[model samples]
Target chain A: MKKTLVILFVIIGFNAFSQTANQILLNTYNKFSKVKTFKNKVHVDFNIPSINIDTITGKSYYKAPLKFKFKFKGIAFLPKDNPFLIYNFIKDSTKYIAVLNGTEKVQKQNCIIINVIPKEEGDVMMAKFWINPNTNCPLKMQITSKSNGVILIENFYGKYANLCLPDKTIFTIDMKKFKVPKMVSADINSKSTKSKDSSTKTIGTIIFNFSNYIVNTVINDKIFTDK
Target chain B: MWQLTKIELFKIFSKPRSYIGFSAVTAIAIVIQIALYADGKSYWDFLIQSLDESFQIENLTFNGNMVCFILLQALIVQMPLLVALVSGDAISGEAAAGTIRSLLTKPVSRSKILWAKLLANEIYTFLLVLWLGILAWVVSLAIFGSGDLVVLKSDSLTIIRGADSAWRFIAAFGIAFLSLSVVVTLALLLSVFSENSIAPIIITMSVIILFTIIGTFDLPVFNQLKPFLFTTHMIIWRNLFDNPLPTEQIFVSIGVLVLHIVLFLAITFYHFKRKDITQ
Candidate 1:
């Protein structure tokens, strides 16, 4: 009779802790989910070893669910994973299991770290988010996806904190297969690429900064589809 | 010495071989431009295929600057051969014709004669490089219009602005001129050794081919030897287009080419001064 009582108590405590985790995640996701559509001027600063690219600025559009597009004048190196995909996954409680992994301070803000495991197998195998409980805004996210091995992102929020819009989101990606193409040039003395190691990967970073947010506004669907 | 150089210049231009480099450069440049005009977009698509998944690339075009850059790359390799033809025959041609004996008996010092010949060969090489520049860059601009120059390496590609390419092209051609001059000096040195003109030209080409082959491979032994080869520095002209241009490397290549020219000239002068003239 004593052992049965202890087991029952243990199950109740575990269920309570899980419910609290779900509440925290839901609260955080709700902060940013209010907007049906948003358009903002995005400035991109990219860095990758062996790649030389200039700073580019453009307009970024986001529609509810999963519709994001960058309309830039020139070329840009963007991360493979959608930045807002985690929001949709977090909002849909049935698609994933969110567990409270206790609290830790990230950049002096006390954050509640949650370990997310997707119920269904997809691009995102596992993800961890550090959300500031005070503001209900995410401070950092580390996602491991199928295509890109490991992506670490740091989010910084300023005036847009109420809307959960980040002033800047820095993404550090270690791409396993950012393949460099080889063309058959007519030059006779061109070196053979036999020496280049294909197995080795490179780390690249993209700093996405946003300002002048016009949220809950009607954005043309053509902006996403237009080439 | 100036008058003698002028006479040597006359001799060079009078030969049918002198026009070969110019005509060949013109024909090759035009052919490459035509091919690019027909189907360059596909080539670009192939090059950026790997990056397509990660990037939304826009405003990319195969413009005149790119065509010129491609022409320069293709032609630089063969420029040395064209230059070697005339330069190798400068001394040995006279010997083969039995004019070298009587010419050496003149009142002028052997050093002056060698200088005059070297000066004449340098002029011919300069003209060839100029011809290449006109056909590759100037004419290309006239045909295709101007845009960014996209330079591709074995593993990477750099996009240089259209406005910025003019200085880089000029600097590249200047370095290219210096590089070809090294070939002229080397051929002249070989010419000093052989009595027959054909031998020197063939030998100079053989050396260039051998070094280029070694540089093309990635073997341990070849890598060790690459830094010492003149051919290793020959392509450094492309460095002008590299972002954060490798200034020290460019200077080193220029210095090495200059040293080679001076050393080869000294040796040629020394050997020819004491050489026995017999037909």
Candidate 2:
């Protein structure tokens, strides 16, 4: 009878362990939902072969759901959950239809591969992703846009374990042909990498340091409702 | 000389294309200002938030009104290019248009005609700069209301009071005009080498872009070269936004830019006079 009881408890414990992974993710996401306001610092580094662009240090603030503000030095670029992004996503949702490519392990985490045909026809090519089964996160994002062309964004899970956020994200993009407006005021000029030729074979690296991780801080009431 | 200059000025203002650049300036400024205004709160919050991390202080308020400041910031970088578009063409376009030969028939020396064109271009550039100042400052304040001018640079944030903004703009505009005049001179010099006005404009702008890219390379080689670049001087107008205005560096930038103008004009005059205009 004792042996039977032990076997039942073991089976129950394995089932509970398997269930906790999804449960933990849901809880973390729920905590995120409860977070009304918080602030964090970001150090953005662009790596190009020939350019040693200056490091941009900035702060980011979010007030739930759709509002995200990024202040770099003193100028600001805000990308929020406006209708534009939502509408574009909704409209392009059909375009994201993918043909099964193949499977590969991204940072030892298994991911499904799919090729996407971008709804908007341009130099940029598109690829799609369905999350890896082991880690319920974005497995792959690839674009074929040249200059504004195809880029691939893939996330690895090893860095921030149980963080519910993708740990290591890599963006593979073609820089030589990327075309942005000459006058769009962003840090474009400051982020170019140096080119290496026969005369110069040296590659340069820039390290960005970020600290002071404050989470779930109380925010002013007006910030969320002001705009 | 005065009569010749008046004639040249007349020719410039009468052309329909002269107004296109101005229209573009106003249209672009208005579009961007409106876009920024519609999306300002989040923008301001982002700026403030970025500043919040490096800065220990709390409740940092932009003493300057947001709209006016954004207008000025936009103008500072772009005005020079717009000014260059017209000013660069004043000499080269005249040459390309085959009007230089008729103008030269007035018994005035080629050098004198060149000088008149240069003077006319400077006046036109100054006027454009003034227009930008008025449109950016007066119109912006009218639309957005008056406050302090807060300028954010890579390393620091500058705050200028509402009362002091006008004079600072005047100084800034002066510097901007002077910097563009150098581009004008460079384009005119390129004009002497080529009959195609568009080619000179393209070449001049390319040179400016190349130099600007080089200036930002942040290499030991570029560090020495940065001080000499006219593009470096172009932004010196921003010093007025600085609380303790870096006057020495501003003057030095102005002097170097003026020297470049002199050198370019001299070269253009020499080349224009020596070239056989038989074609």
List of chain A TM-scores, every candidate: 0.88, 0.47
How well does model 2 score by local distance difference test?
A: 0.59
Candidate 2, superposed: residue stretches over 4 Å from native: A1-227, B50-66
lDDT of 1 at A90: 87
Docking class of 2: incorrect
Tens digit of per-residue lDDT, candidate 2, span A17-80: 5344334334334433544555656565545332223345665566555565545543221211
List DockQ, one per candidate, in order: 0.25, 0.02
lDDT of each: 0.85, 0.59
lDDT of 1 at A3: 100
Clashing residue pairs, backbone N/CA/C < 3 A, model 1: none
lDDT of 2 by residue, B110-229 (tens): 888888887777777777877777777677667666655555543234555456677887777777788888887887788778777688777887888888788657788887888888
iRMS values in order, in angstroms?
3.6, 12.5
Among all candidates shown, the one with the greatest lDDT: 1
Q: CA RMSD for every model? A: 4.5, 14.9
Q: What is the lDDT of residue A95 in candidate 1?
A: 84
